[model samples]
Target: MRHILVHLDSGERTAVRLALATELATRFGARVTALFAQSDRYGPGIVARRAGPALEEAAAAAKAAAEAACAAAGVACEWWQLLHGERNHVVAETVICARYADLAVFGQYDPAGDAPVPEDLVEQVILNSGRPVLVVPAAGSYATVGRRALVAWNGSREAARALGDSMPFLAGADAVTVLSLRGAVESSVAGRVPPVDIAAHLASHGVTAEVDLVPPNEAGVTNMILNRGADLASDLLVMGAYGNYGFPFGLRGSNTRNILREMTMPVLFAH
Candidate 1:
C-alpha cells in the first residue's frame, strides 16, 4: 500500500480517519490524498437556493483541513481532487478511481451505520471499486503498529484485494489468522478450486497466516471470526465484501453483507 486515496466527505475528515491514514502512510511510506467531492446535496432547486458561495466556502474549509492534516503528518499530500455532484454519485466515482489506488481509507458514522445516507453509498462503491475500503468507525487513533489482525479469506478477488491491501499491516501483525467461512455463497463448481490458494497468496506476501477452515452450519460466522480475533487481541479484521448482484457486484454473499453492516473493529474490504 504505497498510496492511499482518502474520501474527504463529511465522513473522512474525522480524527479517526486522519489518525488511521497517517498511521498507515507513515508505516509503509505511502502518500495520502485527501480527496473531497465538491458536491451539492441534491436537486437543482437546492443548488439554486444556495450553491456557488456556499460550496466555495465549504470547499475551502475542507481543503485547509486536509492540508493541515498532511502538514501535521509530515507526509506528502495531494488535496487537488475535489469532485462534484450528488454525494452518493461522487462516492461512487471515487470508488471507481480507487481501482487504481493502493488503498482507500475513510471514516464512517457509527456502529449501527444509522448515519443519514443518500442511498446505496457503501455497497455501490466498496462492491465495485475492487479496492480495499477501510472503515474507521469513530474518532479514535488507529494504526497497524503492534496490532493483531483477523483476515477473512475466501479465494475471491474482493477478498484477495483486501488481503493485499493489508500487507503493510500484515507484515507488522503481532498475530494473524485467516478464516475461511464458506456458506451458500458459491456454486458447486466454485468448490472445485480449493480456498488454500488464498493462504498461499498470503504466504507469498510474507504474511504469516494461521488458516482456519471453519465448519459449515456454524451459526454466527461473523461472531465466530470476531471471537477468534478477540481471543488473539486483534484490532483489525480483513475481509472481502460480498454483495448481491443488485450492487453490480459479483460477491454479495450473505457473509460479506453481514460483516460490513455489523463491523466491529476497523475492517478492510475490497469488492
Candidate 2:
C-alpha cells in the first residue's frame, strides 16, 4: 500500500476511481500515480483521423481532473501519459507501470461508451501484471474501504494466492470474515484443511479473522458471496480471479465472471 497506480480514463467512473485511490493513499501515506493512455491515430481510416483531437482533449481533461483531486486531497501524486496505437500497447504499458506499484486500482468496465481504458483491462492486468488489482464499481460512491472485508475462500491455488496478497489490507481491517461455501472442504480426506486454518494463518499475521461456512443457497455461489458481502456491510471483498491467461474471451470460472459483472463493493482480485 505504499505506491498506488490508478488507471485514469474519460468515463463517468473516473471520479470514483480517483477518490478511492486518494483515500487509500491518504490512509497509508502513499504516493498515487494517475495514468492516462492516449491512442495514436495511425490507422488508414477517416474515423481514426477524426478521433485524434477528441482523444487528446479527453486525456487532457482526465489528467486535469485527477491532478485537481489529488491536490485537494493534499497527497503526493504523479501524472503519466502514454501514446499507444492498440489496446495491447496500453495493457503492456499498464503492466510495466504496475511493476513499480504496490497496488493497482481500476474502474469497472462500461461497454456503452468509448472509454479510454479497454473493457477487459482489469482482467488483463490481473492476469499479466502479477499484482493485486482493486476494481471500483462503476455506479457507486465508496467512502471507506479496507475497514471491513469479506474474503471469498476456497481450497484452490488462486484463492490462497488472493488471501496472501490481501494481507496488507486485512491486517489493518477491524474485522475480517473468511467465507467458504458448502463442499469447499473435502470430508473424505484423512487430513482435511478447513477455513479455520485460513483464520489461523491471518491470526499469525496479527489479523484476527473469523471463519464462516455458508450453506447451499438458491442464489448460487457468486450471488451468495455478494449477498453475504452486503449482509455483513463489507466495504471490501477479497477474492481470486479464476481464469487462464488471456481472459475476457477465454474460459473464465463462473464465480469470477459473475462477481466481475455484478460486484457492488470494491473487490481486490489476484490470480
Candidate 3:
C-alpha cells in the first residue's frame, strides 16, 4: 500500500495514470517508481545491427522524462530503461519483486496487438507479486476511486490481502460489500468460517460493510460482484483477482479479465 509502481510508456505519465498515482501517493505518503520498460523489439534488431545509437539515445531520454514526472510529484523514484525483454509481463514481474513495490498502479492496457492479454499482465502482477494493483482505464480517471466501494470477498488468502491493503480507499468509501462466491470445503472439526468475518474486520477499522455469499456453480462471479456494487450504487469495486498457476497452470481466468475488460467500474485487485 506504500510503494506504487507506474509504467511510463507511451506518454502515460502525464494523463490520469500519473494523476491517480499522485493522488494515491499523496494520500498514503507513498513513494512512486515510474518504470519505463523498453518494448521488446530490440534483441533481434541488435543482432541484425538495426538497434543503433539512436535507440540507445531514445532510451536515455525516456529515463529522464520518467524521472521528471516523479520529481514534479515530490517523491523519490527509480527510472529504468529495460531494453531487452517482452513488452508486458517481464517488466511487471521485475519491479514488483526486485523493487519490492507494495502496490502497482497502471493505466488500462490498450495494446496494439492484443488488449486484454496485456492488461492480463497487470493481473499477472497481482497474482505473482501478491500485491494490490490499481488500474486506471484509458477513458477513466482517479475520480472513480472515492465515495463508494464494493469488496468481493471469498475468505481466501487473495481476498484477505486485497481487503487488508485497500483500507485507505475503502475507509474513504460510502458503502462497502464483502461478497463471497464459490463453495468452501471446510474441516468438520471447526465451524463454518463465513466471509462475514471480513466485514467484521472492516467494521473494526470504521469501514461499514455488509456480508454476502453466492451459491456454487454460479455463473459470472465477476458480474455478480459488479451487479451487487451497482445495486448498492458504489463507484469503485475492490476485490481479490484470481489467477491460475504460473507455469503449466497459467490460464487467463474468465471471471478474472472478464471483470477487468467489461467492468465499467474500477477494480482494485490483489492476488
Candidate 4:
C-alpha cells in the first residue's frame, strides 16, 4: 500500500493502532495520514456547550500521539482533523477521507468507554470506501505483522475480494497460509476450481502460499480461523467482512462480528 489512512482516537488502544500504522508505513515506504474525528455529543444546553471543548482536547491529544509515533518511526506522515456536529458526520468524514488512501487502519471499537470514533465506524468505512481495512484489537501489543499471515478463504465473493486486496501484504510475508473450512465451499464449484488456484494466483504476484482444508469441527468457522491463526503464529489475518442484510447500524455477519469481538491480532477485512 502506498498511502495509509489511520483513524485516531483518544481511546486506550490508540497507541496500538498508531504503532501498527507507522510500522506498515515504514515497511512499505508509504505515506501515513492520521485522521482525528471529533463529534458533538447530544445533551442539554449546558452539557452541549461544554462538549465541544472536551472533544477538541481529546482530538488534539490523539493527533499529537499519532504525530509523535509517526515521527519516531521516521515515516512520512500528515495529520487531518474533522470536526462534526453529529456522529453520522464523523463516519461520513472518515469514509470520504479513506477515498484517497490505499489502506485504512482502525482500532477495534471499545464500548466500555472513551472511544472517539463511532462503534460502527469500521463497518461503515469498509462498506462505503471500497477499500481494505486493517483493524487492530483493543488488547495486547503486536510487534510485527504481515510476516506470518493467515488468509481465511471460503471461495465466496467476499473472500475472493479480500484475497485480491491483500496482495501487497501477501507478497511480502515470509510464509502465507490459506485456510478453507470444510462444507463452507459451494458444492457446485468445489471440483470445478481447486483452492490451489488461489495459491497459483498469488504466486503470479510473487506470494507463495500453502492451502489447508479444515474439516468440520465444534469450534465453528470463526473460532477455527482464530485457532489456526494462533497455531500458525500469524501476525496478520486476512478475511472478508461478511454481512447480513437489514442490519441497522453496521454490516457484519455473525462470523465477522465474532472475530471482531475476540480477535487478539490485527485483521485485514474487505467487503
Number of the top candidate by TM-score?
Answer: 4
Poorly placed runs, candidate 1 (over 4 Å): 11-13, 38-52, 81-85, 109-119, 143-146, 182-201, 243-251
TM-score of each: 0.78, 0.86, 0.75, 0.87
Q: Write the per-residue lDDT of candidate 2 for residues 1-271, one digit (tens) a residue.
A: 7899988877777888898899889988899999886344442135542335666677789889999989998888898876643667777887788777889998777667456566666777888888888988877799779889999876566777788888888989998998864243354342655434666778889998888876433246777788888999999999878743212233557677778899999999988
How would you encode candidate 4's per-residue C-alpha lDDT over 1-271 as one tens digit per residue?
8999988876777788788889889888898999986456542135443346667778789888988998899998899977543677788988999888999998778678576457788888877888899988887898668899999876667787888888889888999999865343444356766545677788889888898976533246677779888999899999888753212233458788888889978999998
Provide the overall lDDT of each model, using Cα atoms, as 2-decimal numbers: 0.65, 0.77, 0.62, 0.79
Q: Superposing all C-alpha atoms, what RMSD in Å does each candidate have to the true structure?
A: 4.6, 4.2, 4.9, 4.1
Candidate 2 local distance difference test against the native: 0.77
Record all residue pairs in model 4 with backbone atoms less than 3 Å apart, i.e. clashing.
Answer: none
Best by lDDT: 4
lDDT of 1 by residue, 1-271 (tens): 7888776654443546666687778887999877665356442235443334545555677678777877888888887453455565556666776676788776544444323233455566677876678876554456543377888765566666677777877888777888875443454456575554556776787777787876545566667877887687778888767734212223437776666556657777776
- Candidate 1 has its poorest 10 consecutive residues by lDDT at 243-252
TM-score of 4: 0.87
To one decimal, what is the Cα RMSD in angstroms of model 4 from the true structure?
4.1
lDDT of 3 by residue, 6-64 (tens): 66554443345666676667777898776654444444253542333544565566567
lDDT of 1: 0.65
